[model samples]
Every structure is written in structure tokens, then in C-alpha cells.
Target: ERLALQALDRADRLGVAGYVLGIARELTGDFAGSMRCYEAALKLLPNHGAVAGDLGRLAFRMDMPEIAAKFFMHYLQARPGDLEGVNNLACALRDLNRCEDAIEVLRPAINEHPAQPLLWNTLGTIMCSLGDGVTAVTFFDETLRLAPEFGKAYHNRAYAKIDLGDVEGALTDCELAISVAESAEDLATMKFGRATILLALGRVAEGWKEYEGRFSADLLEAPRFTIEGERWSPGMDLASKSLMICAEQGLGDEVMFANMLPDVIEALGPQGKLSIAVERRLVPLFQRSFPQITVTPHRTVSYEGRVYRGAPEIEDWSAIDLWTPMGTLLETFRPTVASFPNRLNFLVADPARVEHWRRELENAPTGPKVGLLWKSLKLNGERARQFSPFMLWRPVFETPGVTFVNLQYGDCSEEIALAREEFGVDIWQPPGIDLKQDLDDVAALCCAMDLIVGFSNATTNLGGACGAPIWMLTGASSWTRLGAQTYPWYPQTRCFITSDYNDWDPTMQKVGVALKARFPMA
Candidate 1:
């Protein structure tokens, strides 16, 4: 530890004690310790732009995004011309979920440093995050112009083009990115992007091959499994080997693929043991849904645990040919709506809860029980496709004998009050139901309602699961495609798309008309 003290002494002499200590703490895997050191150093050298930037980065690492944003802004104020400061500040703002503010902060720096490839690339990422893929594509193109070998920029541009429905353009960008990618991570990203684009364009054969890149260590880092003696093929596999199918992506993906468990079992035959690793919360749902498979409750593979000799782990199955989740597999085998699963039996709400909601609805009126969700998810890339709060359900609220219910979460008290006061409509909202609560109640509420209307969010997912008749207002650049009225997972749901990138009026108008016709009151 003498060497460590000498390093600290050197850092103190350079007036960078905080940064050095923070770095040392981070290297030792003591994130909380690093944060404290950074905080202490900031107290001594408050106006040091570089130290402030490092502090902000440390806060971000700790997931204290709001604090990180504050420090990043302070760093930018102290050193306005520092490119690193500007970039870090922009990223912090983005993490704090101030996407528009992040864009505005980067605009001036981008203008000043037009030839800086990284700046252009960052600007592109911010624009994409803000749901402005059309504009993001331009920034990404500029990044490529400045640095043709920039693989990340190409990969990002492909994502933007995909959002804009320029499938061909996205494919070209992905190909270019794959060619220039040096690292396994970059190559996997490019490959996945290409696979998604190909699947969207209905090019299944190539898409499935590229989609296998998700299994790579650079992507998931999860162990692959293979049985010692077993023949595996597309149509026939009579192996008694245990196959562990782990959830690789988001919650929605897990839900989507859960419908295909029967198909997987069929492919492997009765002798094969099918084990699945999924989120802990979903364990109950999956267990209830599929009794045939052994459901494992593990979100991620543990790298530190001692290996069990008897039981088959994910690592042992690496040699067995793995397949992508149901959606990707369906696309590869039969890239059409006709092949969609018809036996999707989503769990219904508790009978008592459903009956209680039904009684409440019955006592109110003979009018239409309407569920309203105003806000869209800010975390997803398609936030730009969402209509303003005021624009949503305006026409529907104007309709006679329609009771509007608030299904929105978070800080929506103002919006709830405004809707009640301005429209003279009853907004049904229960007490003690905050964002922390699981969506089970919301699903039950949807079941009680005559119709559910909302922007694309968990509400839609909940409504779909309960088999409630739902009208979804979707963004133009949404991951869910256009002209697809029905989602395979939710047979009872219908989607309404925005005609333009940011316009919601037309979609809202259609919803109003549809609601009026479906449930008319005297």
C-alpha cells in the first residue's frame, strides 16, 4: 500500500486529489467510496471543470442521474468550450430524461465543431433518443462524412433509418458498419441491427442467421449449452438433453416468446427436458401458463457461483444449436400474419377484483366506461411519435355520455385535475395506486371497462393480456409497424397509427369516431 499512498501524494501535488482517489476507488470496485472521494475533491476545487465532469461521471455510474446532471451542467458553465464537458453534460441530461434539453445543449457545440466526428455521432444519438430519427439520420450521415470508418455511427444511423421505415437504407448502413467494426461488440450490434431490419422487411432466411449474433459473448455473455450425444435439427430432434432457454432482452420480448413454449417442446419431442430462465416476477405467470416445462427463476447467469456437477447449466448447452425467441423464429420460419399463434390464453384478473370494478362501473351509468392513458413512455426511442396530453382524448371527451378514467401513472395530478375541471367529465382514479404498484390492478380495471384507449405503453400491454377491447394510438416511428391493425399477442387489440411523424390529430379523430360508433348512449 506504500505505492498507493505515493500515488495519492502525487495527485495532491497536482491539485487532482479527488479525481485520483475516485479513480483508485473505482479500480478497487468500491463505487460508493469513489463517489465520496469525488464529492470531497469537488469541495476543495469547486470550479475545476475537469473534476466536476469526473464527479458527474461518477454520479452517473452510481445511477444518481439527477445529481450527475447538476454537476455536468456546472462543469459546462465553468468550461463552455470544453468538448468533453459538453458531451458529458449532454449525456447526463439525456440520462436524467431531459431529451429536448439534451438536444438543445448539444446543438451549439455541434455547430462550433462541425468536423468533429464524435460530436456529430453524439448529436445523432441524442436526436434518436428524442424520437427524431429523421433529424438523427442527418447527424449520423455527417458523422460518416467526417469519419467514414466510424462503425458506431453507421450502426446508429441504421437504427434511425429503421425508425423512419427506410429499411433499404438501414440495411446498407448495417452492412457498412459490419465491414468496419473492429470489436466483437460493434460487430454484434451491426449484425443485430441488420437482422431486425431484414425481419421488418420480411427477409426471414438472412434475418434469422444474423439474429444468432445475440448469443455471442460480446452481446449477452451468457453461457451456451449442448448435450454430449444428441442430434439436433430444425424439424427433428429426439435428444433427451435438457435445453435451457434464457430470456435475453426486455420484458415485452419475454412475454412475446412465452407463447411459443409449446412449439419448442414439440420441436424437441417428449423426451427432451425444457428449462427456462426468466425474471422472478414472471415466474408465477409462466408456471401457471406452461405446466410442461421446468421454469427456472433466474434473471441473469451468476458468474461467481461454484459449478454444480450433476445439473445441466447454460454453459453445457452452448454446443446444442440455439434459436432466437418466438417472434424472430416465427419470422424466420413463416414471415406472415397467417402463422401467428392462435392459442394465446392470457391470464384473467382475480374474479373478486373484476366483480368489484364491474359493480363500480354499473352504479355510475349506462354510458361507455372508457379507460384513458395520456402519457407515453419517455425511455423508449419512439417518444416523438406520441401526441401531446391535451391532444389525446379531446374529441373522445367531447362525445356525449362518455365517462373518462385516468389510467396514467407518475406526476399526473395536474393533468387529472385539468381534465376533470375543463371537460366536466368524471376521471376515475383510485387512491394509493402509484407507479410502485404492479400493473395487475390496471389489468383488472381494463377488464371492467367497455373499451380501453391509450397511447402505446404498459396500459396497452395490460389491456391486451386481459383480452380487453383496446384502441392504441401509436407513433409513426414506433417499433411496432404501421398498417398492422392487430398484434399477435393481443387478439382483441387494434392499433391506430399517426399519419405523420409527430401529428396525432388524425389518429385521435379516428378514435373518437370509432368509440362513438361502438358504444352509443341515449
Candidate 2:
């Protein structure tokens, strides 16, 4: 890369050297430098269509989809017949949440390049993202017809089948994907995908075993602690050995997986001391909830023996023998549905914060205070499909003798205004609460509420984790097993799922009826 840059600096004949230097820089992961070089090349040769594509891909990788779309459009203008440019342009539009634009870009590409399996596969993926699983299956079938041995197409097809509620078909595609996988990462991804399908189908034993492929997918965030011994596995004697369970994934996942910690402690017996490392925001809650186990933020620790107990800052290796990811707890602790702790209110809110919210809520009209959360922070088509638009919750907001409080994070001031102006329903937004950062106070607020209702998000998980009565409105395909009305992780929570893709009317109607049962109008 350095040599290419030097050569480009020495002589840029017709901007070709600059283009070569940009490619070299991009290959070396110097995205910013590559973009600069690509821009310089494009400035010299305005008609350099390939350079525009390079800049588009670079911008896409850097999460600047708007910039990527501009470059992709420029490239498409120069070479209108370029199928690859069309596919890339579709990707940029898809990333920008313009699925319709993406579809329009690809429809012509499909007609022009009928033999291109990748184009069909890309269309399938985008359709899956858009929650059009049935349509996505058709695209995947087209890809498979063109290239029967394409591993990624099979994998993509499996995801769509899963979303379409065809677990058996998904499993078959997963097997085909695994069979055609060329690389270890591809094989691991197929296995992990199978795990998700299996787990979603409530096949816990095999699902957890296949979930170990997550590490092979190069997706495991480094564990908080360096293990002195082997990773914990089935039939491992935890009674005599202290275990450290490191939290992985999002805040919601950590909260969900920690449900197995109590079982781990009981299995460890009196001789064992289990330590849990979680995100900093959850440390206080975890410490208060599980006093028997040591809870700390993720860190590097040095220790000698079992005696170094000055608030779990450091631990002794002699006492701590085994370490495992929090998700791994499912393997042994929760082998069956019957074995679930089934305990709600595992998480306890700060009494002072709870009291503060309660006092403030008392100032409002006398009614059942309901906490409302609508959208997730994750900006993706899948998440968007799961959300019941603020407008969809209109009928519930109109319920008599029920006061709604805003627990929905992010800037929804306009939506709140619309509710107040159009529907004449006032959803109260509490002052001085940063719904994103101040999670402890959020938990306290949830605890104080008569009930919390929302789509699946971190706030809903946090509220459910705090043992609040949460009515979680979920999409058709949730990562967690939604076979039963209630999730295994949260005992007090009731899940209300949409009957079809993006349909929340039935769920909202059910919530309305349930609300009437709980808080009858005088």
C-alpha cells in the first residue's frame, strides 16, 4: 500500500496510478485514505466510472449510505448496463431504509441479468429484511435455480424460511448451506443459523450445543476475563470450582441470560463462589439482586488464592477454576422448561428512585399509570417491522381510566404531539430522565408503573427483568422462543405477538381488553 501510494505520488498518468493506490489502500483497511485517493482519481478523470463504484463501496462500509447512494448513482449514470453497479446501488438504497428504491433498482437488474445468482440472492436478503418472507423465498428459489451449489443463497433462503415460520424447511436449507460451505467461517455461520432456528423452535438441548459455533463465526466479543483453565462444558463439576460467567451481546441479552445465574449458584453449592461480569449499567442492579454472587463490571483481574475478597475488584485463580459465557448457562442450568427458575422480580429497583417516580406520578389524574415504549434504537427493516407505530397505539391511548407515560426512548416529540393534538390523549413524558443513559431510573420508573406495554426493545427487557408486568408486542419471528404466551426468561411478562407481518391491530385490541380487565373505568 505504501509503495503504491509512493508510486502514485511520483507519477499519476491519466489518474490510473491514483486508482491503483486507492485499491491498495482499501485492501489494507485504510478506508479514509482510500476514499481520498479515489476522490483525487475521480477529480482528475471525471468519467472514471469504476472509481465511483469504489467510493460507493467505501462509503457503504463506513456506514455513510447517503454518500454511497450518490456515488452509486454517479456510477450507474456512467454505465447504465452494469449489473454489478445496480446490485451495489440497491445495497446503498436498502441501507438508507429505502427498500422500495432498492427493489426498483434490482428488478431491472434481474430482467437484464437473469443468470446472475448473486443478484437474486441479494434480492432475497433485502426482501427478508423488509419482512416479506414469502416473496423472499421466491427470489431465493430463483438463485438456487441459477446456482444450485451456492452456499450463501442456501443460507439466505434458510433465514427467509425461518421468518416464514417454516422451521423444517429452514433446517433443510441450513443442512445444504453447511454441506456447500467452503470456509470454516461459512460452516460456523450455518451452524449458528441452525442454532437460532432450533432454539426458536424450542429445541433447547441441540440448539445450545450448536450455538458454540458462534466463536468460530469470529463474532464472540473477547471475554472480560482471561481463563486460566478450560471453558465450562456439560457435566463439569462446579460444586468445588468457582466459575466466572462473562456477559455477552446486548443489554437485553445479558439480562435474559442472567436468568440462569441463580441456577448456577445453586448447582455450585456452598463450596463454590460464582462471579458475574456484566455491563456497568447493570452492575448495581445485579449486585443488589444477587448478593450471594459477586457482580462486577468487565475488567482484567490479578489474584492469588480465595482470600482476596475486597469487593470482587480482584479474585484468586485457585478459587476460580472455570469460566463461561452467560449464554452457555442454558446448556446445563436450563436443560428443560420445567427447570427454569420461573421467578419474576429477580431484579430490584432502588427504593428511593421508585418512590420518586411514584410521588411524581401521583400528581397526575387518578388512574392506572401505564409505561409506553414503542420503537427500538436499532435502525433496521427487521426492527422496524416489529414496532407498532405510535399511531397504531391510538385506540389503547384512548382507554378510559388509564394514564400513559412515555418510556419510549429516542426523539419522538413529534409523535407525542400528534397523539395529544389529533387523539386528545396525553402521554406524559417525565422530566430529567435520559431514557437512554439513566437505566437505573428507568427500571425504577417501570417498577412504579401499574403496567408497562411496548414492542420488544431494551426498555421492555429492562422493565420485564425488573419483574414489572410488561405486555410486550412482538413480531412474527422473534429471536426468543415465543411458542408460549409468556417468555421463559420473564415470569411476570406477557407477550402479545402480531398475527401477520407488520399487523398490530389484534395485539393492540387484546392489550386494550386486558387493560380494561386490570383497570376498570368507574
Winning model by lDDT:
2
Deviation in Å, model 1, residue 511 alpha carbon: 2.0
* TM-score, cand. 1 vs. native: 0.75
- Model 1 has a clash total of 9
What 10-residue stretch in candidate 1 is worst by lDDT?
302-311
- lDDT tens readout by residue for model 2, 1-522: 667667766886548778888898766655677888899899987888999999898887666789999999999899986888898888888877788889998998788778999899888878877767788899999999999999988998987877666777888999999999976647777888888787777777788877776656232222234545567978777886788887876788888787777778888898888888887778888888899888887643322110111224545656678888778778787765566666986688888999999999998777889988888788765456556766777668768978889998899888899889887988888888999888888889899999998877778888888888988787555657534445777877777776555356777888878778778882
Off by over 4 Å in 1: 1-67, 107-111, 114-121, 124-126, 181-187, 204-209, 212-245, 265-284, 291-337, 344-352, 376-390, 430-441, 480-485
lDDT of 1 at 247: 58
The Cα error of candidate 2 at residue 429, in Å, is 1.0
**Candidate No. with top TM-score:** 2
Tell me the spans in candidate 2 whose CA falls farther than 4 Å from its real position.
1-78, 182-185, 217-230, 299-319
Error of 1 at 264 (Å): 3.4
TM-score of 2: 0.85
lDDT of 1 by residue, 212-314 (tens): 6655655533234322334333444435655666554545566655555666677667677777766565566566556787665553433221111112444
lDDT of 2 at 480: 79
